[model samples]
Target: MGAVINQFVINISLIFLFMSLTFYVMRTVLPIQRTSPLFVRFWFGVSNGLTAILLTINAIELGEARIDLRLIPIALSATYAGPFGAIVTLGLIFIGRMTIHGMSAPFVDAILMFIVFFLFSLVVSRVLINRVKGYAVYIGFGALLVLIQVTGSVGTGVFFNVFVPYFLMLSLGAWLCYWAAKKLETHLWMFLLHTHRATIDELTGLPNRYRTLEQMNDLEMSGKPWTLLVIDVDHFKQLNDTYGHLAGDAALRHIGQTLERNCPPSGFVGRYGGEEFLLVIEGSEDAKEVAEELVQTVRHTMFECQGEVIPMTISIGAAVAGHESSMVVFERADEALYVAKRSGRDQVRFA
Candidate 1:
């Protein structure tokens, strides 16, 4: 009896160890968000398939019956990957059981258990989006054990000896898997937030200079025709001298908001630096028209700061990309911007 209990404990430990290793591989090796849907399905199929096979091979023996924590993988696959994944996992388990146990009473019992588990999983998947719904796996698996006992698949003595211990193991395993998955989710969200912060300007909520350059590089690599518009606020330093830096900041924020809101869908806008903004328009034949529109918008808009009405205008330089690199194109746009400022500020110049 002691040896039987010890074997059960060992089997439970091995099952959880396999589960933990699967999660570790998923966290470290798999690109969870970037993977294709077909690839995701294949991943869940292979991982949970192996888990089912492991459970079958290491099943605890009790008077001509075998018991394993196979439900853990099935429940998790369903909860995390949804119905399609649950179906795949169930099919894998069925194949594993048939290959190992052959056509017999034990095999039939396994099929019955799989059917019950699959249905329960379907119900659980709907609510699994809420973390608290995870406990349903325990109840579902517990009901599976009761079904097995009521159906007389196991003798009365073995049912009493095994049911409680197996249920306890399943409950613990389910909770651990849930905890690990939640932790991984939290870590992924934090990573995304940090990446966003690094690439976005906090004050204006626009893409920062670094992100703009990255986009420019990507656009250049695409080998498509595009345009860059460099805009500078006219008399910005003089305005700062008159109204103070806080008013200058308000002016910058207002300009960023106007450019972002009015820019065409094909265009990207960013705060290039102090009082300067960059706009990228893809596949544009109307670069001059867009530039003129932007200049007019800035010229007409009034910026309010601490009961002072500040009137502002912007000078824009437009350049089209052909055989030149992004940096060269940007430099040409900057030169056109200088020309606009020289020709008199409130207008657009093309290079």
Candidate 2:
């Protein structure tokens, strides 16, 4: 009995180690924003399959029965990755059990136990996913052990002396695995939020200068035909001085929204700094025409702040990417912007 209990302890430890490795890979290696349905299914399938294989190798033998932490993977996968992942995990465990036990009565009993657990997983997956740290999870684990014992051909004494210890170990193991996964998930979310904050403008909710420059680097690497448009709000300081900073901020926000709304599918628009914006449009034959449309849109649209209507105009400079670098093109666009401002603002100039 002591040996059996020790074996169960070993099984639990192994299960915890394997589960930690699985989550570490998920947290660090997988690409963010690319966890498609197929990818989730495949990832959970493989990870749970490995868990089952490990459990089979380290299974504790008690007279005519075999026990392991196989249920942890199934339970975690079902609750965390949904029904599809659960089904794949179940299939893998069945295959692993068959490989270990062969075609015998013990194998048949194992199959029955797995079926019972699978049904229970399906019933409680949604609840567990939402709340896995409560008394409900403990109760569910107890019920699972009861069902497995009743379904198996083991005697009452064996159930108490052997299976009960395994049940306790697995219950603690499952809770620990779930807790670690939740922590990693929270950390991932916070990391993504911090990354987003770093690359986006606070006021306009548009990509900031750093993110725009990163996109420019990507465009440069692609080596495709693209146009850069440098836009400046005409007489922005005067507008701010006359209407106050609040009105100026409102105007900038209005312009940002308009540019975002009118931006082409193949174009990127970002807040470049105070009263300035940048645009990157790909494969546009008439870049000046698009810039003119933007100028007209801003010129005609009325901005209201404190119940006062304010009209605004923008000067734009356009430059197409040639053999010159993105920064060189940007400089040329800035030069053209100066030309547009000198030739009378509220117009577009090409370089």
Candidate 3:
């Protein structure tokens, strides 16, 4: 019992190690986001399948009972990745069991037990709604698994010793491994959420001033031709004074969304500062055209709040990149923007 318990603990640790290592590799090394859902599920299924194979290889033979926490991976796979993932794991476990106990009664019994478990799991999956409920169901599953294994194996003398320890350890191991994995996943996603928020404006859903400047600098340092358009809201202070600050914020949001939607495929639009926006177009010579288009777009669009629709306009300043730095280019655009505002509102000026 002592040796069997120790080996089972080792298997449990392996599950955690696999989960952590795989997550690190996918996050840092691969960095995949825009992939098909089916592809992601397939990849997950393969990983779980391999994990079950490893578990089967490390099985502990207590008399006739070949006790291993193989089903734990199947349960977790089903829990997280769904039925396809569990089926893959079960397939791998079948191959593993066949490899170990060829042409034997143990193999036959194990298959029958797995078939029963799989059917029962389908019912469990349908009945349970979330991981919390699923975990509670898992205790029952683990008990049944232990009973099946003990009934088939373990001559009368060692049945009690094997069943109790096996059930307890399997439950503990599965739960601890699952809890640790979820904890790590939560912290990882939370960190990513915070990091994403750092680069985004909460009000407009646009890149913040800091992120915009960073990107502008990167494009400038590349030593390639780019266009920068600086846009200012016409009479924004007047609008803020006429309406409340919340309405002013809503107007900004409306303007940001409009610019984002009309931005060219090769361009990026972001909130440059209060009442101002920046459009950075790389490898294009049509800054004036884009600026005029944006001006027209804003003039025609209406900002509606609290059943009131207000006409909005913008002044744009366009500057083509030269040998100068990003700050110099931005300053030039800013000056041109002032010229547009001075000349007339809703105008595009080139620098």
Q: Model 1 over residues 1-351: C-alpha lDDT tens digits?
A: 686667666755665566566556665333332123765755765677677678779887765656676776666666656656667878887888788768888678667766776676666655524534654653476466556555555566766777766666667666766676567656765776788899999888899999998889999999999999999999999999999998888889999999999999999999898888999999769888999999999888988888988899999998999898999999999999999999999999999
Which model, 1 or 2, shows the larger TM-score?
Answer: 2
Query: What does candidate 2's lDDT look like per residue over 1-351, in tens digits?
Result: 797778877866776676567666666443311133667656766687778778779888877776676767766666666556666777887787687767888678767766765666556644534446432453466456656556557667977876766667666767776776677667776777788899999999999999997888789889899999999999999989998998889889999998888888889999999999999998759687889999999999888888888888999999999977889989999999999999999999999
Best by lDDT: 3
> What is the alpha-carbon lDDT for the whole of candidate 3?
0.78
Ranking by TM-score: 3, 2, 1
User: Where is the poorest 10-residue window by lDDT in model 2?
Assistant: 27-36
Per-model lDDT: 0.77, 0.77, 0.78
Indicate which candidate wins on TM-score.
3
* Model 2, backbone clash pairs (residues 3+ apart or across chains), number: 0
RMSD of each: 7.1, 5.2, 4.3
TM-score of 3: 0.81
Q: Can you write out model 3's per-residue Cα lDDT over 215-303, one digit (the tens) per residue?
A: 89999889889999999999899989999899899999999999999999989999988999999999756777888999999999988
Q: Candidate 3: where are CA atoms >4 Å away? A: 1-10, 21-43, 58-67, 95-108, 128-130, 157-165, 221-224, 306-308
